[model samples]
Target: MWHISEYDIDKAVIKLRHENADFRRRLKHEMLLPTDIENIICMASFGIIHLELQPQIIKCKKQ
Candidate 1:
């Protein structure tokens, strides 16, 4: 979703870091760290989204 905007990276970084703070932490004073947001944006650039479906996790049976 962010790979457009004429491929503008600077604006992307600021928007992501500044706008998406609660996504990283819930504390009122806590915000997404600079390095962490940068890393996230970098991964997003590669279309890589990491998530864990805790309730859907199922162990495979051993043969």
Candidate 2:
């Protein structure tokens, strides 16, 4: 079974920050944004990464 604890989330973000160039670029843009756009991009990144890690969870709901 796939689990997504806080540790797993932190690890995934760290891994993506280092290994995924597109994610890293989006993260940079996300940080620079001063509005809800940052939240939108950040959520999108998490959604994409979550799907990559656990494709079986179609809705990507937290458990």
Candidate 3:
């Protein structure tokens, strides 16, 4: 299973906001499985941060 953190999401969002070239490239290079991706989306939808978010970033690859 993969893990994703709020900080990771925050960083990703930040990179998105700033248009960070490297981060954007990285996010696009790898994607997470459906289960893990859904978990992160669900947490974000509810405005809750899961414990796992700190250790991993949401994968950019296809499910």
Instruction: For candidate 3, write residues 1-63 as lDDT tens digits.
Output: 545567766754554536655544554566443444444455554545444445455555355
- Model 2 segments beyond 4 Å from truth? 1-3, 31-63
Per-residue lDDT of candidate 1, residues 1-63 (tens digit): 434343554555555657767632422344434454445555546545443333332332445
Q: Write the per-residue lDDT of candidate 2 for residues 32-53, one digit (tens) a residue.
A: 2232233333444555432222
TM-scores of all models? 0.28, 0.40, 0.30
Q: How many pairs of residues collide in each model?
A: 0, 0, 7
Winner by TM-score: 2
**Overall lDDT per candidate, in order of appearance:** 0.46, 0.46, 0.51
Flag clash pairs in model 3.
4-53, 5-53, 5-54, 30-60, 30-61, 31-60, 31-61
| Residue 62 displacement (Å), model 1 | 45
Error of 3 at 33 (Å): 18
